[model samples]
Target: MNFDLQGRVAVVTGGASGIGLAVSRAAADQDMAVAVLDNNAQAVEAATAELQDRGFKCLGLVVDVTESESVARAVADVEASLGSIDALVACAGISQNTPVVDMSDEEWDRLVAVNQRGVFTVAREIGRRMVARGSGAMVVIGSTDTIGGHINHAAYAATKHAVAGFVQSAAIEWGRAGVRINVVAPGAVDTPLLRTKFDDETAQRVLLYNVPMGRLSRPAEQANASLFLLSDAASYVTGTTLCVDGGLTTGFFYNDQVH
Candidate 1:
């Protein structure tokens, strides 16, 4: 399906790598002018260079989403360089696997800052413009943990839950303003983030065991979902969390080979 996104401008937070990078590339592939925002300056340079080499209009900026002033500056820069933002994909986030009892105050606060506040900061910064302009689309990267419970993911899951709630509220408030907001909840995506959380064996024994697809999702797969949500095809879609998991949240898949 044509995304009807050509010549538009898109800003992707955490677009330097992983699913965010994939989304940035996909948006550029659809002929959208892309702005990549990330905290890691080196990764931002590399990603932007790669996209430019591929003949896509791309800009990379070092942005700390946790800081509202930093986000404001980045947003202003994106607008100044690329034009009015037509789309935003809030994919900047971090993950940790410490159990709640064993989690430290620093760890919890850090998770909340990056995962929770980062999403809110970027969305709000861009959302205000979208609301004023009366046209925009946004997709936040959520997780299966947003809906289901997970062990050793207390803080991460909490932040994702908060994101889900924020999307719902934003959708309600922004719907009349022609600004759409939604989320893509991925399960066991094959990104660096996932690899750090589970090794090959542990992934199979712990995470993949519950997946009916019996495989992990690719970063592009998640990006595809985000792209759709950001496209005109999803103009009527907002304030929803679309799960891109490979049936990981459907239920436990017992491989007993029942005949």
Candidate 2:
């Protein structure tokens, strides 16, 4: 029952918006020093300020997860400002719905650069330090698409699958060193990303297709799941992907509640 992490420090990438922001706040609520890392300088600064105004201890760092130097500098800054890192939640990702036929070389590369390479870069960098310290936890954000196929989601699914694999392998490699790695695969969340992707009617159809709850998930709901995994509550849990999708992917359920 010693899940307390009040005196620890954590890093959350893409912490300026959507689910990332919620996760960062959850870490802060547990009284951890949170570093809000993002590629947008202004967004990071603003998010940091907002969190601080809410009386949470936080720092905003502009970082490009795709760049090693950028990630290195940001991690160092977190260490210098908040002491040894206790946890890391990498939620930075980009989504594009494109069929394989419509996907261009540039688009594919860019998506992989941000969604696939970015997770590896951040996790590898932070995980190395954690391994050296012999204590830490990490959470990588994924999607329902990680488990199944979706129309126009080739690149996104591919990257999410990479994240799933990374979590499993990294957990096994680092478990003996006292480090834990896991993934939180969320369903269709009501975030700016989803808002931009679909209009009112299309959104209902796309988001609620197989969702037993008949509603999109909130970012805070996903954050809560991630917080549990990052905390000592999940000390024995690793290399697992906790689906926060509200039964959206539970195939072949009764539709008796419908109509």
Q: Return the top candidate by lDDT.
A: 1
Q: Which lDDT tens digits does candidate 1 get at residues 1-259?
A: 4677999999999999999999998999999999999999999999999999999999999999999999999999999999999999999999887878899999999999999999999999999999999999999999998886677788998999999999999999999999999999998888887786678877788767768898889999998899999988888999999989998767752331211
lDDT, candidate 2, 195-231, per-residue tens: 8767777867656767888888999888888888888
Q: Which candidate gets the maximum TM-score versus the true structure?
A: 1
* Candidate 2: residue 104 Cα off by (Å): 0.3
Off by over 4 Å in 1: 196-199, 252-259
Evaluate model 1: give its TM-score.
0.95
lDDT of every predicted structure (CA atoms): 0.91, 0.87
lDDT of 1 at 107: 100
| TM-scores of all candidate predictions against the true structure | 0.95, 0.94
